[model samples]
Target chain A: MAALCGHGAPIALLSPAYNEAVTIVQSVRSLLSLQYPAFEVIVINDGSKDATLDTLIEAFELKPVSRAYDLAVPCNEIRGVYASPRLPRLVVIDKVNGGKADALNAGINISRAPVLCSMDADSLLEPDSLLRAVRPFVEDPERVIAVGGTVRLANGCRVRDGRVVEIGLGRHPLALFQTVEYLRAFLMARLAWSRMGALTIISGAFGLFRREAVVRAGGYTRGTVGEDMELVVKLHRQMRREKRDYRIAYVPEPVCWTEAPESWRVLGRQRSRWHRGSLETFFRHWAMFLNPRYGRVGLIGFLNIFIVDVLGPVIEVLGYILIPVLWLLGILSVEYLLAFLALSFTFGITISVCSLALEEIQLRRYPKARDLALLTLAAIFENFGYRQINNLWRIRGLWQYLRGSESWGVMTRKGFRAG
Target chain B: MTGGLLGGLWTASLLMAASSVLFMTGLVIARLISEAGRARRRARREALVADMMSAMDGEADAARLKSEVREPRLVARALLELSTLIRGRELAAVTAALTQAGAEPALLRLMRSRNGEDQIAACEALGLFPSDKAAAALKTRLKRRTSMRVRIAAARALLQMGETPDLNDLLAAFDIGEVHAPLELSAILDEIARRATEAYLERLKSSRDAPALRAMMVGVLGRLGRYEALPVLLGAASDPEPSVRAAALSALGALGHPDAEPIIAAALDDPVPEVRAEACDAAGRTALAALAPRLAERLDDDEWLVRFRAASALLRLGEAGRETLDAAAGRASPRAMRTAQMVLAEAAA
Candidate 1:
């Protein structure tokens, strides 16, 4: 099915970069190696403080090109457009620091393909990723408005020429925990949501969207931290309002590898930012909160967001506090308290392990029993401390949301370990 | 008091926790056992692929190949794996040897499976054995009311077998309707048109009532570089549906026929922004030098894409277009000046 799907539809891959000099070249190289018939890679350097533009120009022999772009979507002023004389498929845009959303908008403006794929500069797609990701669009072109693929951690993988040549579990405990968390998130949660036709979030790490649909939906809301989720929700809202038949799909076969944060501080900041972004999107689209007008997307999709994202954090934090307090105040017995905590932890482990088992059975990307065993261990151990820390970060994000904070905390990157 | 009210909750929590732990442990053990078995099977398959490759290269005899072919499914898997790495005579040798070993019956049986994955795999495997029987089975799959994926796979298999179904049959097999005009579907149409251009063109002519289908067919003709499609495309340039008109203009642009200059010139003033934009693009693609002035006039068009494409079209008109762009860049409307300057800078670079 995948081999028959990718015929000759030109697609544009948009990679929005901000201070990504370390990984941009590798990412572009991997994208250029994709096995699609026709595609162009447009790298938008969002006014990085580092020498990202310089590095790209040096690597690809880029020169300023006189290309006209439309203002179909609003973005910051583009500094210049660059293209490599040797590489016809590579286009570079230099624009002001308008955030990732703005950079993506800038990319959408310059790209001329019928379909547009938005990805991060820090992630590398498999060689056949585009061919696999594009199946839904080919299968049902009229209804499938957007599609997302699974993203896996590349922290401990052996990298050669921007490809994950060997898969291994991350050495850091935090990274290991995230590996299981991502497995659960993408394999269990997203797959189920996609089956229900209520997939509202196509990860910013890698997602494909119909160019016209995205352009009509106002191209990634600029000020939102969760621009990916916001764009999808906006699509659902507009399509539902206009009473259009559409689908947002998720395919698990196509895999994208991204570096996971290894440090506690970085992971915390990332989680909090993600939580804050979800909150901002949910609040902005509060009208669709269980509103039947939006169909399943409103009732099921948004309801999931409200339960898991909005209230789950508060309830979790309350459980952490009240379980102990109630026990200390004699309102709850010791046996009852231990049982309750054990149930929560065990349930968390069960979910994580289930996702791991699903991945092992289906993907087998790990290809090693030791890696699976380590992941299983991480899943069980995470319930002891990592999950609690994550909830605390979510609580922090909630606090920041209440205080009306809009800052996107700086996320540092450690470049992939080269072969 | 504590025993009565909290008793049920405690018991339920403990039971749930224990059950979850046991369930998780059971799943892990099951996966580990499954992985170990899979590993052994993978090793055996690797050895079989080695044997098949050796046999194909004539290092080994057909007796060894026949022994391995006892498991037709495994041999088919090996052939599929080696298909990507080997080609030309090596591929033909493998296919002939596998066909002689009777891998066809197993694959044909697999093709009749209810599972979509098995059907897809069977279709691909049958592509290697492009006999009349294989083609017949593939065509039968195409005619079935199965999933689109299976149908596409079957169609691709037919193409691999060097069989071009009638254009109507192919369209119906694809389940192409008025609303379903995916780009890849157009590509399949383009591929079919490539094999029998005139027949496909005549089929397209009868699709006038299906506007989307007509537009897609017209676009395929343009991509195929069918110079004979000029008159038909010219008629389509005035299609009632804006989408068809846009498609015709784009196809005309792709064809770059000199006779399309007049229509392309008039389309610059099209009421629809998309048509006008395609007109500007067509003007540039054909290098309609005579339409340089008309394309220049569109620099002040209301639509940004139209203005951009017009400026690009002027740039393609050699010296005349460059002078117009230079003039516009120096003194024109703010929108036009910005577009002109950007276009010229790109040209200079």
Candidate 2:
């Protein structure tokens, strides 16, 4: 066959970091090792109280540079800009504490590439991920505004010099359960949704976008907790309103690896924040809910997010509490209860196992049969208690959302085990 | 009646749970078997590739090499590996050997298969063989298949074959109304620009094409730096559509042709701000000393991008332009002054 094109288009990779000193250097190293020919790495140090900036400066020999940036997108004030003489492609922006969305906007302002990728500071990208993720942009430059790839859990993986050296199931049960959950969300639901041309969420861990489209959509909104999802929805709304053809794609390959919360406390905070963000985004774009003007995005995608994602948890939590009471009051039959439990647990396990199987069929990161077996066990185990607890967390998040709480709780991380 | 209904539900649930468990077990086993099979196949292919390489170095008989790697899949894999590592006469020899082994027909059959996975794999394999037959099969697939994956594979295979598909055919395949990933289109266009510049130019001359299509082709021409197409591009610069004019101006900038300077300078007065922005960028790229004054005037363009590009163009004009920007930074309109200061700060860094 013909030789692949020598050089793909240039890309600007934006990673918004906050108090991530432990993983910042490693992440930068990984970005440096990407296989794409033309790209730049811009890390927005979002006023981290930790030594994130110091670590980056020391690792890359960063020196302050008086750079010029057009404030096309609104963002917080940047304290300073630094560039490494040693690694010319690496740029760091020291900005005030403006959350993830604001940091991304600041990076977008300074980015010069036609294509931009917004990613998390703690996520590690596969060497060929950019090359693969960039395929869609090269194929349909006119309509494809954004593309997202599957994000896998890195909690159990072996790392050496910022690369995944080996794949294994995490020792932590919570981490294992999260791994299975991620597989289901990314491999099955996302692929199906993208095929229908109604994919809504491009994980903030790693999403590639057309620079012009993002600017036209007014960049990431400041107040939304789900900036990533909100930006995608806004892009959909904007492009549709302008009567332009566009697509938001989801690539099934595992392009990004992130550390999942290993402890229950951290996991609870993360899930609650996620649920609250979903609630806010759902309410914010309520016009699209069942609105014919938005087409499938409104009718199918919006409804799915509402009924399945937002409301399903509430219904499940209520069932958990009310079912036992009904049984005691003789309003529910013992046989019916047994049947419901069997169906729910079995169906849940079946879906999770199928997702694992799908992963095994394509881009099998897990190397060992034992790892697959363990993941399957975790899928079954999650249905027994973990899933219920997650539902409870969503319920609590709904309560907080109703009460008008807007706080993003702190999340502690145990840094990757680097070689 | 309620008791019977409950019993039926319980039985159904019990059966479902059992079947699901069995299904999970079956999938696990199937995965294990598939993994083992893949490992074995990979090892065999690796060994065959090693032998093929040695043979190519004149250490073994070519006939023996072909016979040893007789399996169609193995032959395709070996050829793909060799294509990347060797070129010219060595590559021709490998291709000839693979063709004699019936690799082309085998791949063509696979390309026509109903299985999507098999079809994609065949497209990848066909990229190694640049024959008329391979190109025809790929083009047929491109026309016949509506599956985006199949179409992409076919297009990539045709590009690999070094076949210059008609620009119209490509545009038709990449319908504007249909959502296609930009990266894939860019790659195809880049390949066509690199290998089939003449065909692209021919297509660019057709006024009958859609504006979006013409715009894209013009963009490709610019990217290819086809200096010979300067006259056509200059004519396109005055097209009725603003997008076409903007694209043509961008191409002129990319081509960096000094002769286009007069035309580009005239575009500064275009009604559309986008066209003016491209004109300003082109001025910077060509860096005509005479355009520096004109570019300086544009620093006051109402559009922020136009002003930004104007200041950038002036900076590219060396000492004279820098002096102009300095004056603007000191006493021009607020927007112009801010733009000049920003450009100056960037230059200092």
Please report the candidate that would top TM-score against the real structure: 2
Candidate 2 C-alpha error for residue A333, in Å: 2.4
Q: Estimate, for each residue in A1-419, the C-alpha lDDT of model 2 and write its tens digit.
A: 00011236578999999998987887899899899888999999999999999999998999999776678899999999999778989999999988999999999998877689999888889899998897776555556789999998888788887888787778899999999999999999999998998998999999999887899999999866789999999999998889888888888874798889988988998888888888888898999999989989999999999997687997888887898899889898777778778877877887887788788777777887778888888988998889989988888888878988877788888877665
Give the lowest summed-lDDT range of ten residues in model 2 chain A: A1-10
The candidate maximizing DockQ is 2
lDDT of 1: 0.83
The per-model DockQ list reads: 0.28, 0.30
Write the residue-wise lDDT of candidate 1 on B243-325 in tens digits. Answer: 67787898898899899988988888989777898899899889888888788789989867678889988988888888888
lDDT of 1 by residue, A320-355 (tens): 798878878888767766766766776677688778
B226: Cα error in model 1, Å: 2.4
Candidate 1 ranges with C-alpha deviation above 4 Å? A1-6, A138-145, A211-216, A240-245, A290-295, A333-350, B1-60, B85-90, B113-118, B145-147, B174-188, B208-218, B228-246, B258-275, B287-294, B318-332
Off by over 4 Å in 2: A1-9, A240-244, B1-8, B11-19, B61-67, B89-198, B207-216, B235-246, B262-276, B297-304
Which pairs of residues collide in candidate 1?
A65-B346, A66-B346
Model 1, residue B66: C-alpha shift (Å):
1.4
- TM-score, candidate number 2: 0.88
